[model samples]
Target: MFTKSILTAAALAVALPFAANANDGQAMQAATLNVDASAFTTNELAQIAAERGDTRKAERAARIQAQKTEVPGVTNAGRDMQAAILNLDPANFTTNELAQIDAETSALAKAERIEKILDEKSGATVSTSGVKSLTVEYVHHGRDDA
Candidate 1:
């Protein structure tokens, strides 16, 4: 409906200048159809109408053709769900730890694997003085189950 109105307004705008210059009295009478020239897209037309001291038409036309925008396919719910699924927090762990967690195939298996690792002995200390064998001290704050 709005599109048809715009097309009609455009066609009238195209023919208006010639119509205004006609010499016949009938043409002069036709010119007084009471339609304003500036009634096309954008607020520019409304601005023109206002400058010509027709505030009522300017406001009316402004309301009719106000700008509206929307993303083509993305709904608010879809966007929110995507955000929630991808929202991984890494504040408590290092990048290596995060990579280890990400390598798990399933959530239940991942949790079980982490639990088994945490249950093992970690951060065991050995005396370094006169030691023939090297003692590798592994400080495990969390699981290293990559």
Candidate 2:
């Protein structure tokens, strides 16, 4: 499960590349699970995942978690699904999390209309820890990383 940091790290490393390369202008499968991070809700998440053709186990679990938590719990559950498409790196996701992403996020959900971050200028590398910041240069064609 992705709740574990080590597993998530390993999974994401492998999933990111796949996701990044999967877009063939296929209308960019929207992240229906793409929460506002502010308005994300338990029932909404479960319903979205279900509409996206995800398994019942995923929706059930999310529902349960939502009922128990005060914040409706938002984890990187769909990291794998996203990685296999948007990230070009599967290692960026975990085993279970990937499943959740696939189960949740939908096409209409992705229709929230986000401003495009296109072109080389859209790429940025900023890593910060506490008051420390680290910079590294990497190439992102939005399709592949070099």
Q: Which candidate comes out best when scored by TM-score?
A: 1
> Where does model 2 exceed 4 Å of error?
1-59, 62-81, 93-125, 128-146
**What TM-score would you give candidate 1 relative to the actual structure?**
0.20
How many angstroms is residue 12 displaced in model 1 relative to the true structure, after the best TM-score fit? 99
- Model-by-model lDDT, in order? 0.42, 0.40
Best by lDDT: 1
- What is the alpha-carbon lDDT for the whole of candidate 1? 0.42
TM-score of model 2 (CA atoms): 0.19
What does candidate 2's lDDT look like per residue over 87-123, in tens digits?
Answer: 3234433333333434545532222111111111135
Q: In model 2, state the lDDT of residue 64.
A: 44
Candidate 2 Cα RMSD (Å): 21.9
Question: Candidate 2's C-alpha lDDT?
Answer: 0.40
